[model samples]
Target: MKITVRQEKAIDFEDITLLNDIAFGQEHEGLLVERLRKKTPFVKALSRVAVFENSIVGHILFYPVKIVNELTEYESLALAPMSVIPELQNMEIGSQLVKDGLETAKNLGFKSVIVLGHKDFYPRFGFSPAVNWKIKAPFEVPDEVFMAIELLPGGLMAVSGTVLYPIEFNM
Candidate 1:
């Protein structure tokens, strides 16, 4: 099946929410997406959807977040709540969304991205443990599940601190 990945449109909101709800078996992720859209850090171009046969089957969002210490704050993108409908799982719809989203982020000048995801799945896209760069999640998480990918060489070289997600993420 051919899947088309594109930036989300206003008309796709409900479909994206439903897709996230079904994929995750809950409304929390859907709500998070909605909340993030209203926040200052939301990057509309980075919220994307995978379309199969004219229907949205997958969604991915990359929101701006900060990595900071006493001296400075580095901006980065956070990949969260990516999802594909259950019937389409493993069909590479999610993969397509990720690949397209990351490229869009890089083109938009984002230096790096952070994701709390499956260790095995994300590595193929060049993601590795964020700990390697001395980055920490605001909350406790296993090292391997929290990963980062540098969109540009030395993207994270000068960055090392705890990530500060938006308030919407904490809800």
Candidate 2:
């Protein structure tokens, strides 16, 4: 089974939404993707999909967010709601999407990315606890689960503050 990863297209919208819903066993993530797509912070290049047999089997989205303190606001990307079809969960489809998405993000000029995800899975991609860099999540979550990765050298080194997600994330 071969899988191809590529930037999402308008034509893949419905498949992506359905993929997210089925993978997550809920509709909230699918709805969030739709809402975020309409917002200014949505980076088209960073939203990727994994295609297997010409069908979208996985999806990942990285949206603009801020780490702000009184002195400054550092722009970054947030990896949220990454999904893979249940039947394909352990086949590395999600990994490919993440790797491709992160590369696309860096190439597009994004410096860093944060994710609230499985402690074990993300570490393989070089993510570490955001707390190590004094970064905080908008809500309470376990330290290991809230991770961050630098796309370039020292990407998060000078940044320290709470992440501010978009309004659509809460809706």
Candidate 3:
């Protein structure tokens, strides 16, 4: 079997919507992806599509985030609403998407990447609870489920206080 992963294109909107709908139903995740695309210019092209059999079987999104602190501040990234087609779940597509997104964020000088997700799931990619770094999500969630990955050395040091995602996130 041959599979390909490519950056989604303007013409791919319909396909993206289809993928999201199948993966997450017609609700929150679908709406969030729509809002993110509508609001953020930095969707990180390299982060969006994972194709298989010429279809978008997996999708992930990363957007700008901020960890405001008294001593230091830096631009960060947030991972949200990742999805894979129902038939493709548990097949590691989500993992590849996340790994690819994080690598891109790291190369782009992003200091950190945050994810609000399942506790058992995200840590394999080096995500640790955000609270350990004194950072937090805007909404209430389990501390272990709000994870952050420091892309650079000591990247999260002195990074306390609320983690502010862009307004589009609708947290």
The runs of at least 3 residues in candidate 1 whose Cα sits more than 4 Å from the true structure, single-residue gaps closed, are none
Tens-digit per-residue lDDT, 43-82, candidate 3:
6474578888777888888888777766766677888768
- What alpha-carbon RMSD in Å does predicted model 1 have with respect to the real structure? 0.7
Listed in order, each prediction's TM-score against the native is 0.98, 0.98, 0.89
Give the range of the ten consecutive residues with the poorest summed lDDT in model 2: 41-50
Tell me, by lDDT, which candidate is best. Answer: 1
For each candidate, what is the lDDT? 0.93, 0.92, 0.78
Off by over 4 Å in 2: none
Task: Rank all candidate structures by their lDDT, best first, as comma-separated numbers.
Answer: 1, 2, 3
Q: lDDT tens digits, residues 50-162, model 2?
A: 98889999999999999999899999999998999999999888888889888999999889999999999999999999999999998999999999999999999889999
CA shift of 18, model 2, Å: 0.8
